[model samples]
Target: MDTATHFAMGFGLAGLAYLDPVVASTPALAGAVMIGTVIGSQAPDLDGLVRLRGTAAYVRNHRGVSHSVPALFLWTGAIFVLIQAIMPQAHWFHLLSWIFLAVCLHVFVDLFNSYGTKGLYPFRDKWVALNAIFIFDPFIFAAHLVGFLLWASGVDPGRSFLLIYIIIAGYYYWRVQVQKRMTELVRQRIGKTGTYTIIPTLSWTNWTFVAKTEHHWYVGELISGEVIILDTFTIKPENERIAAAKKSFKVQSFLAFTHHVHVETKERPFGYEVKWIDLRYRSRFQGKSHYMFVAVVYLDFDLTIRDSFVGWIHRGEDQLAKKLDSNRQLS
Candidate 1:
């Protein structure tokens, strides 16, 4: 989930704190629980501080260790101690309970989105992306907003959010069913032997998908139960130049972050340009296809790395090429 949504959920959990008799009776303890919940909700994302280092470092470690099993308990304990220090009169166990719930919910929700977390780290080093929910679902956010509004307007927050959560639970079930149907459509219409990755978009009825067969890559969208293939690329065999490009640290980090990757190599006037596209993300504009997430590496005639760029592409392909050209010249 995005930062805003996480913060909103923190408030929702604080509203839920109204259910506790101790918190409901004491204003100071209630304030302490609110602070504890908000901080606990964002504790795992402290890894965002890694952005100060560089994009490569951020991508490699963003959700890797920070959202792990041990981190959850560690964050809860640290947040509880901090909040308790500020408000000694607050009940220890009640503040700790709300903080722990906030931390656990933060990690649990991240697993449902496309950019999943390493929740099972150390025990199993793999990203657990259900791909059933978008990173920022408007419906989920609206529910939290409405619940908060009602709480602000003097509605009993405990009763209001309780009903909201039940509806949200049903919404999650429906989404899981929709995800299953999308997977079935791909298997029936495309090939069952291949691997299919379903990526949810912000729109409810639309989805993006990347299917890998034995010899080709299929990139498409699912709209209104229809599988609309936007583009296709062949899975070419790698050569020596291509092999050398993957040795760079930037390319290695990209490979570690994603699984559905496509690599292309082209000869340039100065050197060779090796492009890696994460097929899970594709953009279309004005009847053309654009790969949004990519890493471009420029190698000399001898395949020595000269320059590289590994990040998301906001501008069109032409601008991306110009940017790569600029980077190569500076190098």
Candidate 2:
């Protein structure tokens, strides 16, 4: 799940726990304590890399240690030890004192996807069945989707009201995978340049994409089935219709925090290839450890967000192959 969404989920769930005492009369600090219970929601399937590595190999495995209940316990114990060492003044009940509920919340969010997490791994070897959606999908972010909508509508949120927000966000992880596949297929056949990378169009269309091939990139309008090929290397000043990228203050801050901020303006055969670090951990769909907001840079074109990355249409990998076979001159 995206960090912003996670934060929202955490904040909302914590707020809801807080509301428990006030609304349901649970108890004081129950909500705040629930916040810690939610920790490790993303923990269960820490062994995801096993299956991800593929079958038929001793070195390859899924649901290994992280999927084990014992692992979770060990991790929690380690957490407690750290808490004791660092915050001896705090009581054990003080979550910041000796427990890790945030870890549970993390694992909960992880379980909502297709590749379910090992929620009770150490306790039970069964994977929690969450057939609701994929591991990550932008569609589920509909609440995050509706969030901006509600914001625009001037809807203000109160404490504990965050539960609705967390439920929606926890569900958003499933939707991200849906868009991820769509974007991947788009790149699989865009061109033979092999220089392309699927860029996320989160701001424009959640499922939208921009293909950055070696010398070119194409913005696709998946719905209209339109593909426009833009010359990435040949740009003249007269080509004033170039697009502009919207500055995301949050993403920018993340990059800046890691000292990965970069902006380049150089001439290209087409227009410009805005190369910089992809500190934005949007590549997790492609497979990576944690969503590392590390200091790194990657190339993005000016037309990405502007023209909506609508350059060329992919004929599909099979279609591209068939077209190539037909075009090969009979030697």
Q: What would the TM-scores of all predictions be?
A: 0.95, 0.35
lDDT digits (tens) for residues 32-134 of candidate 1: 9999999988999999999898777887888889999999999999988787677775488898899999999899889988888899998989888889999
Instruction: Report the lDDT tens digits of candidate 2 across residue range 2-89.
Output: 4455555544444444433342343333433443444433434354445444321111224334645566566566555654465342
Which 10-residue span in candidate 2 carries the lowest summed lDDT? Answer: 305-314
**Candidate 2 accuracy as TM-score:** 0.35
Instruction: For candidate 1, give the lDDT of residue 137.
Output: 97
At residue 53, candidate 1 shows an lDDT of 84
lDDT for 294 (candidate 2): 20
Candidate 1 — which residues are off by over 4 angstroms?
285-287, 326-331
The per-model lDDT (C-alpha) reads 0.87, 0.40
Model 1 RMSD in angstroms: 1.7
* Alpha-carbon shift of residue 2 in model 1 (angstroms): 1.2
